[model samples]
Target: MPRNDDLLDNPRSPRVRAVAKLAKRDARSETGLFLLEGPQAVSEALTYRPELVLELFATPTAIERYDTIEQLADEAGIDVEFVTEAVLSTMADTVTPQGLVAVCRQFPTSVKEIFAAADGEGPKLIAILEEVRDPGNAGTIIRAADAAGADAVIMTGRSVDLYNPKVVRATTGSLFHVPVAVGIELPAIIARCREAGVQVLAADVKGDDLLAARQGGLLDAATAWLFGNEARGLTDENLARADAAVVVPIYGHAESMNLATAASVCLYESAFAHRA
Candidate 1:
């Protein structure tokens, strides 16, 4: 059992106020920490690297539902804070709070780490998102990547903050299962992928190749796929940089698939190809 404190009960506490505001981009950037909410995400964090957790907060009721969380906290030597429902609501992004939230240190791995992990006989599969504005979409894509067993997810340009509360929730705790890198330059990332012998395939609405048809052969040759934003899709510059472009075939009258859906389709195709 860990000691529980109600220090956050003081709304005027400068430290509490500062961390609350750090949920925003500027503060996250300045401090290199992000806020995670709900028991699942916090549980994943504890599993991935307990040392990354800075603090844990829970409503009395929340601790009951997620008893394992308290055990993890005890084993990891993390401080737990008990806060009122009103205070939790203020900090929670969801309407129905799961009764827990955590402040975590950012785990920003370098490009070198990504490459070093891929050194083996088999090909490497990586997912890159360019300027993906929606945190939900980004988080879903990260979850999809994990499902497909991709190496890592790379976020470039002004994509949604990986630590965004919604994104963290959307990941359903897979955010900690996989490695994520953000704020990278697209062109530079392209060069790095090429140097590492990872073929870059960009997903586009008007792509020349159909995702289903190119399945076993196409993906077996490459190492990774690039997914773009929902609204505009991949920019011409990024598309041109890809070794090839792939599109998920749509027979229905639907205009296009959601960004996350499209990425999932592509990732599954790659996984299938590798399995074959």
Candidate 2:
């Protein structure tokens, strides 16, 4: 058991108050950092092994429930602070507070860095999301991409911020496992993929190709999957740029699948083809 300090007792401390207020977009933008609340999210952050964790707060009740986390934090030399329930609730996003939260520095990544990290081999499996406005969907896609062993995740146009608390929570810590490049120009990225011999496949409801059966025959050559926004789907420009359009067959009279579900289906299909 780690000792609880005075810092935890003062919920209105300048830093603690700042973290509480900084949950807003404007404050996060100003600081280039975001707040992560809940035990699950904080546990995932530990896996990332962040170089600088500003603070760690846990309610006594939370420490009792998550003994493993407490032990891990002690081993990692992380200081644990005990806060009042009211304080914890103020910092939490949910009606029921999980009793753990942490503030961490943001690490920005770029396309050049990703290419360099790949040792010039180029990404064999990439997922490109164009203007996905929902943070939950975006985070889920990233988590799926990581699970499918994708080389990278590219966000184009005006997509949701990857570091949004909702997105971070959705990723469940897969955010650290994957390389994400945001605000990329779609057309230019497509051209770069073509130059690298990566086949660009777009996911479209009206696509002529079926995703699963095409394995080892048509889609075997594709190296990347492109997904678009939920409401409008892919734009004409994106569709025109794709080497091929792939669609998942839906039955039982559903209008369409959710964006995150559609992306997961397509990514898994590509993974299957690669294995085949």
Candidate 3:
């Protein structure tokens, strides 16, 4: 149920302020909740993870603009209420939120749980991130992993928080489509993948040329890709832990590929190779 049926017009009201506070990491940590901003993100959440929605706020103009989202939320039994643009501005992180926002409970799953959800099948493809601190890169990687049909994604304890509002916005709700587990020990995840008979491919400039590996049919097997931080890439210790080092071959003079682009290329290559 809504806090009230009447439109919440006051931006300073306790409820509105409380919801806005979710933009902060501390608030999310304390409340175990986060905000979903813009129509794209909120609509995806409502469609894919409606049960996690706690409250839905929209302006009359926004509801009219995004009729499908409002209808879907209503169909899901979520309480949708009108709020002034002032209230929305106060609640959203972006200057323009596309006039939609929702308060959603954090989705939590452990590494073991992610594997268990695989339903007894050997893990085929997974992406493991080591201390990836950039929210945009982390979220884009999650989206790429999902698109590449990764069974799961593991983020080490030092990686960006999955629930961070910026990360959620970057994922555009692919976060909900994929099984993403955080705070797991990297070595344990690697060990589990090895036990499951999956190849561990670590992405690095020093790794074997990706194109050559693909051409040689070396990437046709089940593989888990380990990607390191944006600035540092993977450490020597990190590379030593994997079965093989992999690199995206660059034909041009570009010094390096963007983190997201590199991961996407590697994942899709594996996807294509496996399907063949």
- Per-candidate TM equals 0.92, 0.90, 0.95
lDDT by residue (1-276, candidate 1, tens digit) is 223464356655675676677668898889988888888889988887899999888887788889899899998999678877767776766788888988888886677678774346433788999989998899999999999998888998679888887888888888888888888988988888888788999888767666454743778865668878788888888899998888888889997789898898888888878778
For every candidate in turn, the CA RMSD to the true structure comes to: 2.3, 2.4, 2.3
RMSD of 2: 2.4
Better of 1 and 2 by TM-score: 1
Candidate 2 accuracy as lDDT: 0.79
Ten contiguous residues with the weakest lDDT in model 1: 1-10
Q: Give the TM-score of candidate 2.
A: 0.90
Instruction: List lDDT for all candidates, in order.
Output: 0.82, 0.79, 0.88
lDDT of 3: 0.88
Comparing candidate 2 with candidate 3, which one achieves the higher TM-score?
3
Clash pairs detected, candidate 2: none
TM-score of 3: 0.95
